[model samples]
Target: MRRGFLWDGFDAGIAAALAGDPDTARDHFERVLGEDPLAPGMVDAQEKTRELHALAADREAVAARVVHSCRSKPGLDPVRLAMS
Candidate 1:
């Protein structure tokens, strides 16, 4: 059930991102993060949404990256990725 919420938040975030609503996506993803910070793909979603929000194109591509990261993260995170 918890995982359901996780993915719900994740999917909502991705949908919002793809719809060109980074702020909404961030809000959804924030719920996911609050539920489980260590959940798979969350860090990437957070980071991607942050950067994606600043741009104006390729929202689908950005959302794809976030989904991919959520699918598989090789130890990357918002803070570390942000720093680099």
Candidate 2:
């Protein structure tokens, strides 16, 4: 397979894993690993895949909390948000 194909497959795997499809994600990730065993991005992709899997496994604990702090109610600091 082409390098771009592997890259796209890896991207899709991350998306699938985040969307709660571990089987498909694992298959795609394995394919990516087979395609480029020594690629620099393999480690990062593997780590992110595992993270997404863990997040999917415990989605309830990863709920988003709306922090209503002392900031302005109507607007956010664009610079601060960008930095974050």
Candidate 3:
């Protein structure tokens, strides 16, 4: 099912994040959010999928904020931001 595909992406994202590969995790999470055929005929499944996508988006926003903060701070190691 389409919903299963979305869930697989979400799971992969979580695994990538836990493994410290933010780029890959972001890719998977974005795929989950982009796939729109998750629950073709079920409103409840669609709503749940939307909620999960929102959670992923919130996590993404937080990560972006952290990266931005790290990038703007003076004297911090550039390696922390993978800049060098």
lDDT against the true structure, per candidate, is: 0.59, 0.51, 0.54
Write the residue-wise lDDT of candidate 2 on 1-84 in tens digits.
356476677666666655667677667766666564466677765564454444443323212111112233467542222111
Off by over 4 Å in 3: 1-4, 37-84
23-42: candidate 1 lDDT, tens digit per residue? 78777766665664475576
RMSD in angstroms, all models?
8.4, 9.6, 11.1
The C-alpha local distance difference test score for the whole of candidate 3 amounts to 0.54
TM-score of each: 0.48, 0.44, 0.43
Q: Which wins on lDDT, candidate 1 or candidate 2?
A: 1
Best by lDDT: 1
Tell me the deviation in Å of residue 81 in model 3: 25
1-84: candidate 3 lDDT, tens digit per residue: 245476677667656654567677677766776666545644443454345444444555434444554565675543332321
Task: Output the lDDT of residue 84, model 2.
Answer: 12
Number of clashing residue pairs in every model?
Answer: 1, 0, 0
